[model samples]
Target: MEIPQANLGRGINLGNALEAPQEGEWGIVIQEYFFDKIKDVGFKAVRIPIRWSAHTETHFPYTINESFFQRVDDVINQALAGNLNVIINIHHFDELTEDPLQHEDKLYQIWRQITERYSGFPDQLIFELLNEPHEALTSDLWNQFIINLLEIIREANPERSVIIGPVQWNSISGLDSLALPQDQNLIVTFHFYSPFQFTHQGAEWVEGSDSWLGTTWEGTESEMSAITNDLDKAVRWAARNEIPLFMGEFGAYYKADYESRIRWTRFLAREAEKRDISWAYWEFGAGFGIYDIENDEWDMGLLNALIPHVLVFDKDASPQSQSR
Candidate 1:
């Protein structure tokens, strides 16, 4: 009955690749410089989420070119070499996502190939089944599809950990419908962007976003309490099932004010720690950034105020790591 418990830490998502890595950018994105920043910020882990459909479309769901797989492997090795906990997964590749519940054969084929291919990845290299499965038409449908996906992964990776989330695009509330995988190593994941009114203030893709601009994570005490309470179900489930929980994605979108972003990061870090959950903010650059990739600048003071303390950045090797 042993379960692989993930050591909590702060990390970023390496996105917009497999499609391409901004031509002339050598050696893929797992650069030492990126690791340096993560280390400089005192973060001890890195989560690389890559989208592969464009590159793997050739004989996909059954086969992918070696070049594509090699590219991804190289990036993963870089993070591991830096002594950072590296998590890589098939991101943004869920096909025909218009109706998340379609249960298409292609979807199963995709996982079958992917899980089989990456089945040998080391313990630290966790595999997330899919990323934000857009909103399934209904929770029931979403949950059922995820259940089957879990079976697919378990078939190839019995003990290796895999992460799964619910229909409402990985929202905590949607997590209610998920049933833990039979495998003890499975971790339930949900992205936290609760009370969208605050977190996604200026996010263009969100609905009714007019009044969201200029808004900050500095909502009133009542607001924070309200949002936190909404997560009670997810928290309770993790506690009862003895399955570790991970906030696979959560953060203040880049469009938000810097100060607000810092506050929101602190909020999630604090709440995550309280629940003994591992979390990775939405991204490394663009929108959600611990480091301002474009300007090569980061809100250091904000990092100080919100990071190490609020998040267990170096928990495992950290001088002083906390547990929930």
Candidate 2:
């Protein structure tokens, strides 16, 4: 059961779009060209965040809406068609995370349906069991739930690469408490947003985020050391445990200063690459995105920061082939 990590190369998330309580509710409407544009810009994979709980019933056999499933399937097909690996996960499942005891069965049932639907898809399609497990879903409880859910997923699709993260909002520090299953097809993931005040500044959803709006990441030695130390622990843990690592999410909010955002984004991305850790930027076409959907253009600064080797210029006729 080899980990399908190689396929999850440089990537970005389709956030605030389909994952919105309602598709496009967050102002990003996914068009057919979005996938092509992402691949054209050098992204090798796309993480499709989805709010499956919002679309399902709160009862036995909690079936996901068929229409919604089709829509997701279509987007996934488009991504795969563009030659990019796809990661589809249950995101914003707040209810389950709030009370895993009460909703564990429901979670298992939901995965049963999700796994069955994409069970036949190619190996490039990875299933992230849940996103950012937090709140009452403590590491201990999350461990049990992950074990249970992995059992369900394995029953239907053995050998499929499944992504799991630590509890505490998938904090890197929490990785120490994450328990791995016997399955070798697992990829342990963590989100990097150290100096949360700087990364999440001005994010409306985070409490007290507004107060940190003026903060900036200077990439000082202390800052670099702090980040390196944290990531080093994760790296060492991965090596000691013999599990592959993935930096599933990391980004500075749009409200932050542009230079600070680029600095942090580039440094974090480069650091993750240095560790051979596969990663996907927090999002695309919304806050923390490299592309502005409304303008239908890439933020050249952020794009360059994420993939410094790929050069897109006004005079370069072949954007993909042009590299620094």
Candidate 3:
């Protein structure tokens, strides 16, 4: 059967917000202007990483907090109002990752509530089962979990598009181990941070990352080939499986050299587009931010790389100043 492609062209992840234990805990509150800005800047979609496990009951039934649902609803509505596609998923469920056997039921109930809540939403909304399944959750177990979760979601939303990815933090090599049911509505996703030493240099949570701080991507033939080769693996897998692919996340941390970041970002964006794959840059207004919230302006160099045709100007300059 042929599966239709999801048109998630030039998207950005609303990371470090709801995925954090709290909304503002990571210094992002998902303001209305954020969605408006991205929409105006040419982003067609927004992938929201939500930590539902943090807000649900630890026991059976696993009721989610009503207030939290409203908070998420508001964020989704804001994006929809701006005519942007939205993708929400289970994120940062550390307990489940550490002990999948013990928390299996909890994970099921979490998706049960999420699917029921959003079943009535428009088709513009997408559900990504979980983000970066790893740790104690082996490939076999993760594959089983996908089957179980899809059954639950199907009860409420039979045809809604849902995204699933391979284990090992959604690595490209992990694609060979991924097994999926014969569902045309499913899209395969993978994250790219190849040459992690360069992408994650100085990232606080990554231990020993400080030592990689000065690393840079110069877009040399070898460097470019490395990325192209990695992405090609995904392209081949999707072709064989007859599934559409989405590069769910890819970006360099702010600690990297500014010019190196732009070159890397532009190169990857173009490569993914060339392969007919859609992508969402790892984040917005945080460690890998392209927008500067403090100054209410964009990092135009990085932004232009992601969306090459957007009009660029010095936000600080007045019309008269430019004319003079």
Q: What lDDT tens digits, residue by residue, belong to model 1 across residues 121-197?
A: 77777777667766443666656666787788878788876777666777876666666546767777788887677
Cα TM-score of candidate 3:
0.95
TM-scores, one per candidate: 0.81, 0.94, 0.95
Candidate 1 vs candidate 2: which has greater lDDT? 2
lDDT of 2 by residue, 1-324 (tens): 222343478999989888889997899878889988888778998998998888888798999999999998899999999989899899998888778889888889889999999889999899999999998999899898888999899987999999999998888989989998898788988998888899889998999999998899999999888888888888888887788888889998999989988888888888878887899998887888888777666787888889886665434455533322
lDDT of 3 by residue, 204-284 (tens): 999999999999999999999999999888888888898898999999999999999999999999999988899999889
Name the candidate that leads on lDDT: 3
Instruction: Give the C-alpha miss distance for residue 115 in model 1, angstroms.
Output: 2.7
Question: Which residue pairs in model 3 clash with each other?
Answer: none
The lowest-lDDT stretch of 10 consecutive residues in candidate 2 is: 315-324
Residue 14, candidate 3: alpha-carbon lDDT = 94
lDDT of 1 at 213: 76
